[model samples]
Target: MLKTTSQVRALTPDDLPELHLLLDRDPLVNLFVRNRVDSTRLQARWLGGQVWGYFEDGVLVSACHAGTNLVPVQATRKALRAFAERVLGDNVRPSSIVGPRDAVLPLWELLEPRWGPARSPRLAQPFMVLDRDSRLTPDPRVRPVLIDEFDTIYPACVAMFTEEVGVDPEAGSRSGYRARVAQLISQGWAFAIIEDGQVLFKTEVGAATPQACQLQGVYVHPDLRGRGIAGPALSAVVRLVRQTVAPVVTLYVNDHNTPARRAYERVGFEHTETFASILL
Candidate 1:
């Protein structure tokens, strides 16, 4: 019943339902599904880009997506290696975000030998699920960030990216990282907690599918840490999502981020899986 590795190609319109079945059947990675992962988004990331699939007797079977360089270790490793060997005609590096518990070790096992130990960075990959009925008491200053706040919001995004991921947003400026924030704001997807007009806490839905909204780019100003700002900021975002659309929200945290994990538990997210990101 397994498909061979040769059928992988850019997703076509006919593959949508099958792709959904693949993602939904995955107990460990269901969080990858978001409302934004509609046909258009899926086309851009999985089809327009270099997504590959393995087919057996003309039926699609194993496939791996290479959008962010991170992937489910076991399912995609063989397929990914195939893509690297066949498609790229050389070994390639992929974008990686911290992954969940289940995929972590296997991914590490795959990446460590090739990239060597020093190239690997330890990350805590924690995912959180929300109970829609939960209500977080609001912070008086907490509110949805507005379009007009772009000037301030962009710098906050820059700081968070640089400090957490150690990347300069300036390199991608031409790609409109600022404009992305503005779009998130316009869609009521971004939030900020401010006191005396100074923003203190923030979070955004980094990626999404109909089944879940993923939290990413979460940051609290260092000065405001330990004051319980994240709870309110995150609560507001969850509230918005629960109120407007889906009943559940999910986020991944680094395993070492005890503070963040603790904060997420306070808001009602439970531990799910372990994942790893290896550079190969």
Candidate 2:
């Protein structure tokens, strides 16, 4: 009897159908990859990196999105090792590694020797999701950031980013980070509550698809923290997101963030999966 040999290779446009099927296996958890492929269709030129696929008997079983952010898609144990090996062989140094805890942790374990001393090795993050309207009343003050308020919202964006990622996004490229904030507002993806020209609360809808959308950069003004703001603010974001964006909303938070986790739970997000992130 012949055994099904396993192999890993860079996926191409011709492999998109199989890729879509793999992504569909869990749209909520795989939203990031789904959104990327939807826009780039697995094209390396457009993707800025390759989509590495693990094949068993010539059939794709798992995939990894290799770019500035390395993310795994439905990776099995063998697939995880294969991905790590493939990445190591190619000497890919992504800015961050993020995805399922089971997959990302193992994948990182394989790469850590060569890629040790990550800036932040967050081994456990709760991948929470919300499919229905938020339980709390949506804060009317929370709304899509207006394009004219770009200047007003820009500083808050930088603050949120720096605080969350532990790095100043503007350090690498001020214009680049500024442009991203503007783009989110222009797409109606940036949400915030502003009072007297001050940003009180803010968040952005990152990667999204028809099935699900993921949130990022959620923040409440430092002065406004510890005043029962997060729950209501997130409730507003979740409600607005479900209405205009996708029915399902998802976000992963560091496991140690008890306050944020409690806030998300109060707003109706339930932990459905575990995620891990290795920041470089």
Candidate 3:
């Protein structure tokens, strides 16, 4: 194994170039961090998280974002071990650990004893991406959500979050969660198909940078699902994202969600990588 005086430290704006280079090595998979980096660089508060770098002879080899979510990028066995040790000792408790399957699983294995069992471990999430316009026709009804629609959209957003994450977004208080939904709408990142103030389908461009944007919180009302709605709605969202937000759109789906997987395939998404998440 390559050996040098390994040093791990919190990254700062001065490390931007090195960090950007490392993250760009796998831009699609690293979109989560790259989006934050593009907006806030190496600020400790970027996306409410701090980034740490593992350096060998002053060259960054691996990096991790520790906060609401734990994401390790390009971490080798040594780097993962070091990160696990560092975060465990510091008493940092992230809500979840997510990343490329190969990296997340091993990192979770190292930290599980210290962090306790995850509430759920999603071991196979196909990280899919789309660069070209979708093959399916875009849904004419789906459009960017208006700021005035936050009240109508909030419930759907909460429901989707709870269903997907297995925890109510409004469990503690609705104010904070409500504000987040409004923010996405204000930023023109929220989209939905609504009629009579009822959200039929909804989603958001949860994270973005010039190179790519990630789609999240995709939900079609229970009453509206399985009737050929998601495929075209998603294609519309993908089209809007490619036209106005970024050229590339990416999302990860639970491997077991064969229907969603097929729907995305119908929309022109292809599996680019695999991801895993240890939800705490």
Candidate 4:
């Protein structure tokens, strides 16, 4: 039966232990939240927003990271309703609602009436993972993007973001996006294959834990999309990432992206779960 006695409130540092336990339930899928908590330790000054916890008779059963991404952690049906209530009551509107399909779908259903008409709702996203070297030969040319190659990598990233997300990231934060790309390169999280002065293939480790890491900004040059650059390049990524970043590399792609999924499969990534996103 659904627990009747419950309380939902914004979490604090004191709640970190329970929060950690909850987030650890699925580290690969929860890497983004885990990374944020590890870095900020639930500090609002750093987190920029709150993570709400759903408690049943004094035990944290689930949580929702309310910020640029409204991500749910091990959310139950009851928890989703409570979280929706809290969000609406406080008038909190996140840029996106995303997480595991089971949790994200129900929560969005609860919020869509008021938050109705999402700008872009991606309902079927395959959450894929690769924990070992790919069967395909790694593309030897793909390597960590050097700081000097910032000019070469930046345009590819913008194009990928615009094509994938349907909006130019530079449209909002001109400098912010550039700094992020630079930061990822400096940290050795960004990888690319550049020839002369052009980026042929590129991707980045968007988030990570010691257990696993999530990749984003995967792209193949527009003019060269059909020549099968993604799979081999990602083979290189999986190999290098397993050696340097984490054992498991994960990413979620829209279910409709056939070529991307096929390329990921060619690199030996298997679909482990379904995720959804409601972009606001």
Candidate 5:
């Protein structure tokens, strides 16, 4: 007999080891890579409603996690419904819920229709994956943010978010976003291309694991695209990451983003998986 329960809940620190192994073993997870997660980070992320998992025999077997940018469109939908029905007992509404691709899918598949068309897919944004290898060279001008560059780097970070994620890092205060940028700068996590006197290109390593670092907020100014900038700029960022963290780097791109994908491939990234997002 197959047994199941929605009483299952979000992953806890104690479940980290098991969850990590389960995620690592899944081929689909190769797109995100599994090493970036640990107990503490998972807890913080989960508390934000970005993660949920299922356990069996005291070991975490299945989990669907979401990030700030992408939610699990299918998995989360399934997991949440199962949880609500078995644990909450039908007190919740039947309306569709959406979030990042990784966060929602587990819930989406828990009942029936394990795989089907997305109810509300974010078609404009497609999932992309990049693998790190030595294909391009780092730009001499591009380097990690230094202690003195916060004033300038801060604005660039905000501009990156506005262009990439479509929301201000602070949602309002430009200064607040600056402060958040400052934090990443201090940690040696942010990078930029400095030419003459201004920033030209930039990207951030959103989640870094021993296995891989997920690239996020990659952007070049509108006029700067196809100017032989992205190739070297991305090369520099990936090179730096290989030096400090995982040698493999990855990022999600929209399926329709042909140009970006080509640029990434030129810099030594490969497509490893397809991911869909749910927006509720």
Candidate 6:
């Protein structure tokens, strides 16, 4: 039964133990939150966002990262309702609301009436993970993007972002977007296959904690598609990521993308959970 004294309030560093337990319930799915907490330790001022907790009888029943991304982790229905009410009242403008399918959809239903329609609502995203290498062959050319190749790799990154998210990353300012891409490359998170100054394939370790690293911005140049290049490139990426970045690698794909799913399956990624993303 739902507790009567439940209240939604900002979580603090003192809440770390309980928060860790809650997030550790599904580390792969909750890696974003885990990474945020580990870096900020729930410090309200430094977190660059607020981590709110739903407490019932002094126990944290659910947690929400209310920032650019309105992410809920292990939220109960009661907690979701409380979160929707809180964000609605506060008028929080998150770029997206994303999480496990069960929590995200119900929470969106409560907020949509007031928040209006999303630009695109991805109702089914297969959250997949790989802890070991797959049967697919790894491409020898797949490697970390170098700093000198920033200019060469930037356009491909923008194309991938625009294609996948349906919006131009450079819509606001080209310099800013270019800098972001440069930062990813300088940090050694960006990977690609470059052939004579053209990036044939690209991806990045968007988020990583000690437990797992989440891949994002996966793309193959249009000309390279259907040449049987993606599978081996991705397999090489998975192998490198597991060896150097994290023991396990994870990513979520739009359910309807059969070719992407089949390619990931070839890389030995297995479905672990369902995720929903509402792009605002």
Estimated TM-score for each candidate: 0.82, 0.97, 0.97, 0.96, 0.74, 0.95
lDDT of 4 by residue, 1-280 (tens): 9746999999999999999999999998899999889889999999989999999989999999998889999999999999999999999988889899899988988888887788899999999999889999989999999998888889899998988888889888889899989989998999989998988899999998899999999998889998989999999999999999899999999999999999999999999999999888
Indicate whether candidate 5 or candidate 6 has the larger TM-score. Answer: 6
The CA lDDT at 6 in model 3 is: 94
Please give the clash total of every predicted structure, in order.
24, 0, 0, 0, 32, 0
* Superposed Cα deviation of residue 262, candidate 4 (Å): 0.5
Candidate 6 lDDT by residue in tens digits, 1-280: 9647989998888889999999999899999989889978878676878999999888898999999799998999999999999998888989899989999999999999987899999999999999987678899999999999988988898899899889898887889788878877887899999999988999999888899999999999998787888889999998888888899999999999998998898788999899999999
Task: Report the error of model 3 at residue 217, Å.
Answer: 0.8
Off by over 4 Å in 2: none
lDDT of each: 0.62, 0.91, 0.91, 0.92, 0.60, 0.91
Residue 245 C-alpha lDDT in model 5: 65
- In the range 52-124, model 2's lDDT, one tens digit per residue, is 9999999999999999899999999999988888888898999899998888888888888887689988999
**lDDT (tens digit, per residue) of candidate 5 on 1-280:** 8775444565667766666666666433433424335524566743444355654545454554434332231333444554534423423322233334445455555532533455444443444445544468777777887869877666677787666545555765767567667767777888888666577888877666666677777878767878888888888888888888677777777667778888887887766555544432
Minimal lDDT window, size 10, model 6: 39-48
User: After aligning candidate 3 to the native by TM-score, how far in Å is the CA of 69 from where it should be?
Assistant: 0.4
Better of 3 and 4 by lDDT: 4
Model 1 lDDT on a 0 to 1 scale: 0.62
The local distance difference test score of model 4 is 0.92
Clashing pairs in 3: none
TM-score of candidate 6 on Cα atoms, chains taken together: 0.95
What's model 1's TM-score? 0.82
Indicate whether candidate 1 or candidate 5 has the larger TM-score. Answer: 1
